[model samples]
Target: MDQAVIPFDWARMLLGEEPPTFLLEILLRTIVIYIYTFGLIRWIGGRSISQLSMVEFLLVIALGSAVGDSLFYPDVPLLHAMLVITVIVLINKGLDYLILWSDKAQTAINGIPNWIVRSGRLNPDQTSDRGIGKAEVLALLRIEGISNLGEVEHAFLEANGDLSVFRAREPIAGMPIVPPHEICPLPHVEPSLREGEPSPKLCCFDCGMLQSRAETACLHCKGEVWTEAKMPDSRLA
Candidate 1:
């Protein structure tokens, strides 16, 4: 039989239908979960909360539901929630230990850093494999105050999804990314130059590898498209 629903039931709203003794249990449950979670976080070391790994992300989702539901829901048994949290933390800790000891486990779980640029030339294979496009790389370079691809000697896509760039001590003439591609689109065709004439500073459109005027395809990226290489502006350096 269903009891009649009442409007503005103060006792039901304020205290819920759980026994008064459950309130004490709720306090103990909260304390235990909080302490246990905090201790586990400390054990996991001081990695920034902002940079949560895949395993840590799972921990956050599982713990958030378990802790929140166990706090207020009368039907959610405190012991069950505690056990769930324990198992989750244990799994996380175990993965951490495994990652520390095994290079294969660490690479599998967190991935390895990818070299996206080397010697002012883009690594097309690595970028394509990592699903990083040329536009994205250009944006990252611009964020680092790069005006041209030649300014970068080496650039790596870190496992944590951060781009690390190393600048060349003596910058070379490379493909310019300034003024943005949206504002000024790159040229696709090679410039016509007389035979025996020195190649007019042309670079491969795809990988920024310097190209000879006579070459139909880029030796590095095999891209036939060419754009005039821009010397690094002293003011922008």
Candidate 2:
């Protein structure tokens, strides 16, 4: 028979065969599947999609695909999809148990965190082992608002590929230690003015130059960037 202009086989389209119904059956299937999926996720724990670990992410993707296919495809048996979900959930649970109980298993599965930076210097061994370069490290530090490596006391590469940075409590004092070539005094302030003296000291940020008077331009390098050379008690790392 020639296909209808829109091929509207109401029975076959809605019910698959002539057995299940259109509005009622489809509605029931959607509700049941939704409830089941919700319960499964709840049992797995109340972690948001963003907070899901690598293993959990894969499980969510698999469950979503299986559930969606069974919900709308008449030829796909719901029971088969449910069975697959059950097996996947069981395996996930089993792996979680192993990871929790065995330290070696946990390391093997999730990997160990690498100390990318330590004590204001890049850990060359760790970076080389992980195939990370100086440029990549600098880029990540820049993203965290750290322009100078000396500002960071420590940095770690987490197992899930996130970078955690620990900043120095005090800015490292010396010229060329950090980038941009600005220098903090050896003792952080002039010794004569160190004891209870609020001196109006101005210094160039880009070039290491001690200025006697505040001017619109630096005398030595003519750089405009300048800051009062008062040492702070604490600096954010």
**Highest TM-score against the true fold, candidate:** 1
* Reference-based TM-score of each model: 0.71, 0.49
Clashing pairs in 1: none
lDDT of 2 by residue, 49-157 (tens): 3255555765787678878986776665555556557766766687799899999977765556778876445665666655666556656676787755556778887
lDDT tens per residue, model 1, 127-227: 77666789888887898988898899999977655778999999988888887887889767565566877767788889999875568888998988888
Positional deviation of 146 in candidate 2, in angstroms? Answer: 1.4
- Clash number by candidate, in order: 0, 1
Worst 10 residues of 1 by lDDT: 41-50
lDDT of 1: 0.74
Local lDDT at 60 for model 2 = 81
